[model samples]
Target: MHPAHPLLAVTHPDPYPYYAALAREQPLYWDKTLGLWVASHPTAISAVMRHPAARVRPLTEPVPRGLCPGPAGELFSRFVRMNDSRLHTRIKTLLMAYLQAQSQQACTPQWPAITLLSAVQADRFLYAAPVHAQAAFLGLPDQLHADCAVQIQAYLTALPANANADLIAAGHTAALTLQDRLESHLLAAEASPALRQLRDDGARDGIPAALLAANLAGLLFQSCEAGAGLLGNALILAGRRSLDASTTPAAARTVIDHVVRHDPPLHNTRRFMGNAIEIQGQRIEAGQTVLLVLAAAAMIEPDNAWTFGAHGHACPGQTLARSHAADALLHLLHAGTDAHALASHFRYRPLLNARVPQFDFSKDHQP
Candidate 1:
């Protein structure tokens, strides 16, 4: 029951029990070994997320030589977890055009095909579907979908501790491959009239091209893994509840939200304390790392109803992600197909930062 045992809870598959204990016993307890405080209460969690002193940092700062390795190391170091606010803002702005384009394209005539492909492929076709969807929105060649799928799988399958060196090397190569494609697309977009128009007028202003590209690729990586896991989790939960196809869609959305609350893709976001702060009466030193457990807070907070900002630092993407999930579920439920067929294919792995599930669609679907 020591506060220093934070990793104990993290390593456990279902950390809710541990989180509940921490919430009751040590709402703002600091772990000396981990050099971070666990804020388990809703108020504490919100405070940490919105606090001006809270700043994102690398999971392991000053990344060791030969640790991440090669292209993967370079990309991770350059783009993510560097704690540069100016760069982050720039990237966020630049990607707005692509995000908007994605939104617009989803409503077009091509949507039915894309939706059908997503439904039929489910988890198995994560690479092709998401890439194709992205390509459609970005106006890239659809032929790259297969290559993107292979690269993504390699990246996801890499182990954390005691990982195979060869696998890591493959991951680096995959990242480079995707990076090249993304760069090419960016260059082409700069020259095209339609893409140029969007880039000039629609894209968020003041974003650097490099940062924009990095964030776009990062988004793809995040969404591909999370989206697949969510689809699988939703289907399984719906079937276990014995919900009918008509009701399954709505139930799926509820279950997905619950999953995000109970077992989110990301367990924590690392933030470095910029100034001395007190939480629940304990003073924390500056430069300390604060692990904000969004998933744990979401579960512990009252779920009386769905509302934006229900708890502080509530996801801005909550509405959009939920809407997408709801729509996907509804489409699946009304497909005149057995819902259970898709539910049984989920298999999960222990992800360090997020909960990821492996999906197999070749089980029993008659196509």
Candidate 2:
């Protein structure tokens, strides 16, 4: 039987080949075991994403009920990604405008890039640089970068449907820790304009302080999770192509765009049926799950598909994520080491939606 589970794409080293086969054979099919409809073709995925009947979460459950009464659940409930309400729309607009005002250089690194360039082992730098870039952008203190990453990973692990008890517990602990820290930081962080804006804007919009805190934390979680993966993928691609740090900004941006098109940081996301619908002859009842196979659709047409998302549901942080990744890759190329050396040995963190890379240079003294 064909591997019907989306997690299979996460575990397999090169799932593109499998995705190609599946896309050609069953572009849109129901996986009885998974209890979700998979859409592999670009057109089909786009159709579903923009469909009037599509939603980010189930209509009956606005937030994930399974994770509620805890920090993770609370954050998930307020997360812009999980809601379709008018409040979410207004908040997302404000966030996007804030993100758009940031120049590429503001998001990129210079001193850290130079530091990573001089490391005896670039492996740690490869991972650390992206983490630092994201942390800085989110107005997180440098001292908490490591702890923040750990907590974000825990939350990420517990996001999927089949997460175990251990994962859930860890996520809960991490969420509480993150919540406390974020709240404290927001209260005390008068120096950070972005945080201040989020607070002021949210208040002006009549949003509760707690929800504001959760959304701010959500920004950090997104940065740590997806931002890291995009940077890692760019490094791997540049290493393969022998691209150097001296590459022009325009050139670097092109490479970043290609990477997003070909091997995006996020492979897939799910949507719930908002109303009874017929998609490609398949009758999907309201509340049925639809897996938007972004990676698979990218295989078919990397240019047009909703790699980030579609219509009103698109990720507002796309530009920020790409700029950070491009800057890191430019520096990694200039780091005076063949970063490609690690490309062959690199491994991915097994995640259904994310594609973060993990590297260990201790085993091989490449530098």
Which is the leading candidate under lDDT? 2
List residue ranges in candidate 1 displaced over 4 A. Answer: 1-21, 32-36, 51-53, 59-69, 78-82, 107-139, 157-161, 189-198, 201-208, 243-264, 273-280, 285-288, 300-320, 323-348, 357-367
139-256 per-residue lDDT for model 1 (tens digits):
5555665566567666555524465888788878877876777667666734444345435642456444554555445554554555544544555566666655577555667877
**Model 2 alpha-carbon drift over 4 Å, by segment:** 1-7, 10-27, 59-66, 102-131, 158-170, 184-195, 244-252, 360-367
lDDT of 2 by residue, 126-180 (tens): 4456556666676666677766666777787687778787888888998888887
Which TM-score value belongs to model 2? 0.79
* Range of the 10 consecutive residues with the lowest summed lDDT in candidate 1: 108-117
Q: What would the TM-score be for candidate 1 when compared with the true structure?
A: 0.70
Model 1 error, position 178 (Å): 1.7
List per-candidate RMSD values in Å.
6.1, 4.6
Q: Model 1: how far is 120 from its true place, Å? A: 15
Q: How far is candidate 2 from the true structure (C-alpha RMSD, Å)?
A: 4.6
Question: What count of clashes does model 2 give?
Answer: 0
Each model's lDDT:
0.54, 0.71
Measured on C-alpha atoms, candidate 1 has an lDDT of: 0.54
